[model samples]
Target chain A: MKTKPLILISNDDGITSKGIRTLVELMSELGEVVVVAPDKPQSGMGHAITVNESLRLYKTDVFEDLGVEAYECSGTPADCVKLAKHHVLKDRKPDLVVSGINHGSNISVNVLYSGTMSAAIEAAIEGLPAIGFSLCDYAHNADFSHIRGYVKRIASEALRNGIPKYVALNVNFPAIMQGEIKGIKICRQARARWQENFDERKDPHGRLYYWLVGDFINEDPGQDTDVWALDNGYISIVPCRFDMTCYESFPAISQWEL
Target chain B: MKTKPLILISNDDGITSKGIRTLVELMSELGEVVVVAPDKPQSGMGHAITVNESLRLYKTDVFEDLGVEAYECSGTPADCVKLAKHHVLKDRKPDLVVSGINHGSNISVNVLYSGTMSAAIEAAIEGLPAIGFSLCDYAHNADFSHIRGYVKRIASEALRNGIPKYVALNVNFPAIMQGEIKGIKICRQARARWQENFDERKDPHGRLYYWLVGDFINEDPGQDTDVWALDNGYISIVPCRFDMTCYESFPAISQWEL
Candidate 1:
């Protein structure tokens, strides 16, 4: 008999969050699931790793009813993926690595600031086939019901077809309240940016503090962009790579006299 | 005469690190300098932003001797850039944004985990020209004397010719002790990763803890890669973009049945 695929799971949301719990339940149906995730919420942690501090990983019964083995780590999302790959599952290669049914969107430029996507990206860096799933909702109790089947299908497709090497799928579904998710579209990241507006406030200590808030601005009008797909009520699957090199700029920079 | 180009400087290292000091000294020679860096070291911070907490920014006299206006912020490197552009600088547009003379190398895949490069990447996302510089040495007081002229020339060239839109240059210098500095090579990010090894130990209280330590593994043998340039004693300058999309993988994913 063929052994079931071993699937490793993680998320930027703390291990006990509804998001990771949903992810755990979904991945459990597909493989032998093992989870290593942050002990606290790690939203907006990007590709960060724990360098200056020691980390603690404690096994938890968070997914006891689901029969999923889990460990909660005191580190960033990237740290969880590293510890999972290096220590928790030493010499045991996972067939697929999944991160997040994130509480918020990680479309366009937000991917660079996403702890959820960073976990998947970190897994890809380790040569693992990975996927990061997110819904276009920011509520702590965001409903992930409508997209459960899609998530399973996507993960299954990834397992059967295998994601392209060195890439991670950033899959985002429209919020359930946003009518119906039309379908999935393979797209590229749109040209977008966050227009920052710092909310200045005076604390009780008489010192000024600021809250980092921003309005996302999507400048790309291309129909092939992830932002466009999301706006049209479609799930977007953008294959994100770790190589940040802009090869097109080579000719321009090569002419520089150094 | 035209006012000297305003150069906003920042780094992953704290405002008081020897690396930022060297960067400030070099940038001051080329333009009007404004420094806004982290209050404490933020080495592996990647592109993290402080979302759940308020941030404090205080005017500091660290660069007062150089007559450079500076501020120290209790946040990550990316926060400093956002704060600098949105709150500190306000409507005054900077001509250039430069981060680091980082005390260590940020070559190859290290760029993804680098707080130094995150500052520059954040600037690029804001539609500004930026560059991140690093030295191969990891010492706190590494020698910067040898690469002084090269640093000046690179910044001068950037000031004269704007960086490609939505891109930041990742410039890394070979450590001074690594033989004569050869020249500069505009290269691509090499295919490399850190082979993470968790150093597990027990606390005095008998609780087990782990520290992340790794050996950088360069898997790419391409001569045009950043790793090759640095290994051969050349300064590597890779044009990095904010977009992480793998467009080539679109066709493969498009074939997925959803």
Candidate 2:
């Protein structure tokens, strides 16, 4: 009999978080699961890797009930994937890599700052088919029950048909409060940006400190965007690529007098 | 008379590093320069923002000799840009935002892991014209003497002819050891990835730790790539965009049975 496919899992949220626990449970039924995730929360870490410091990987029974082998890593989500690929898994290549079931949305420009997506992007860089799942909610105990079936279906489709080369699927679901998700729509990242407002405060020592807070502004009105889909109660699947080159702008830059 | 163009300078390298110092010196000649960089080295920080903690920014006299105003912040490169725009500069919009004369190259996929490019990308997201410059050499005291003219010319052209909207220039220079620098070329990021090898070792306390090490493997042979231009002694300028959507892969994903 053919062995079940091996699925590697990780997230920006610490290994013990509800999100990864949900991911671990969901992935167990699909394949043999191995998890390597951060020991602490690393949200907004982007595509960071720990290069200046040494990393610790401690084997954990975080998913003991699921009979899954897991390791808690003292690094970013990207570091977890690197260590998993180069050290933990060794010669055993995973059939699929899944990240998040994230506590927050990674729609539009947030993908640039999402630690959850970074894990999936890092895996994609290693030529693995990867998907990062997120719900449009930020509560630590956000309800993920509504999207479990969709997540499983998406992952199953990915394993069967395979994702496009050099791309990672950024799958985001409408919040549970949105009632039933209309459906899934293949979309492009909407043009958006966060308008930062630094909340300045004085510490006990009278030293000034600031908190980075912002409001997200969607600049694109296209119906084909992920933001539009999510707003309309539909799950959005934007195939993200690491190649950031703007080919259309090449001619404008090429005309420069260098 | 037109006011001098306000130029905000930052880098992944700390404020005191020779790379940022070189950048500050070059930018000073072009316009009014303001420096807000990390207090310590932040190489490979990618686009991380310090969300979980409060950030401290202190006015520093490190660039006083150049008569340029500067501040050092306890944050990543992207954080410095946000702080610069939202808090430090407040209402005085910069005409140009320049990051780095980075001590190492951010070519190909390295751009994703580059803190240097993150600052520029952050600026682009804010609707500001920006450029991130890097050298092929990784030494702390790498020579900046060879590329001064090229750097100046590039910045001049950028100020004269605004960069395409929502695009930031990723400019890289061949190391000084490559002899006299050739002309510049507008190119795309090459397809390349780091093959990571974790150097595992037992600590003095008998706990195992690992360090990330990697070899850059260029998988693209296209002559119009940034890697090719730098390899052939040409400075490469790749216009990078924040949108990570792989639009071409939409058809394949659209057919998924979701």
Candidate 3:
């Protein structure tokens, strides 16, 4: 009998989150699984590596009932992928790497600062097929039943037909009921950013402090953008890469006499 | 008299580092300067924001010798730019945002996890011309005299002829003597990554811990890459964008039946 495909999983919300638990349950149906995720919540970590600090990976029996091996890492999501590939699964490359089922949306400009997407991007950087899943809900117990089917479908498809080189999928779901998901749409990341305003407060020590708060503004009106798809109740998938070179602006800047 | 152009300065190496000090002194000669940098070293911070905690911005006399207004922010490099524009310099946007004179290089794929470059990228996302500078040396007091002429030249050029829209410059200077410094070259990011090997150790409680360490491997052999430029004794400048979309792979992924 052919052996089941091996799948590596991780997330920014730590290994015990309901989102990753849901993801593990769904992915277990597809393949043998190994999880190496942060021991504490690492939200907003982006692609950060723990260069100046030490990391710890401890074996755990959390997924023992599911017959899966798991480890808790004291590092960012990106570090988990690196350590899992190099140490945990040495010489055996996983068929796919899936991150998150993130608590909040990682659409458009948010992708740049997302620890969930960073794990997937790190896997792609290592020449592996990967995808990051996020729901447009930030509640602690957001419903993820609606995305289980889509997750299985996308992961199975990724294993069957390998993803393009140097690219990873940034998949997001609308916060809807099991039957409310309209279908999935592959789209481009929208042009968007946060318009920030800090709320200042005086500390007990008579020092001033501010909380970083912002209103997300989506400037792109195109129907093909991920923002549009998410707002319209469709699952959005945007292919992202690490190469940030602006090819369009290259020639223009290259023309400057310096 | 014509009003002097306003330039904002920041770095990942905290407000007290020699690198930011050099940057301030050099930028002071070109324009009116305001600095809002991290209060502590934030290397490898990536594009992180301070959403979970409160931030603090306090006045500092560090740049008083240069006759520039300066504030030390209790946040990441990216947050410094956001607070600088939104609160500190309200109603008046900076003409240019320059980050670093970094103690170490931020060339090749390192730009993704670089706090210095992220600050510049934040400014670019806000529709401002920005640049991030780095030297190949990693010492506390690396010789920066050789790059002073180049830094002044690039800033002057960026001010005279603005950088392209949605693009920021990731500039790196090689560690060399004054006369050995070659001319600047516009280049692309080299394909490279860190080959991580966590060094396992025992804690005081006899628990195992690991320190993250890695060797960088540049796989791209192109002559026009930033890695090659720095290796060949030239200043490397890569025009980076905040958009992470892989436009080439979009069409192929869009064809998938979902």
DockQ rank order:
2, 1, 3
Best by DockQ: 2
DockQ of each: 0.89, 0.90, 0.79
- Share of true Cα-Cα contacts across chains kept by each model: 0.88, 0.91, 0.78
B111 in model 1: Cα distance from truth in Å? 0.5
lDDT of 1 by residue, A1-258 (tens): 989999999999899889889989998999999999999999999999999999999999999999999999999999999999999999999999999989999999899999999999999999999999999889998888888888999999999899998899999988855357788899999999989999999999989999999999999989999999999989999999999999999988887777
DockQ of 1: 0.89
lDDT of each: 0.93, 0.93, 0.91
Q: Candidate 3 docking category?
A: medium
lDDT string for model 2 (B118-206, tens) is 99999999999999999999998899888988888999999999999899999999995536677888999999888889998999999
lDDT of 1 by residue, B77-181 (tens): 999999999999999889999999898999998899999999999999999999999999999888988888888899998899888999999999998553587
The CA root-mean-square deviation of candidate 1, after full C-alpha superposition on the true structure, stands at 1.0
On a 0 to 100 scale, what is the lDDT of residue A98 in model 1?
Answer: 97
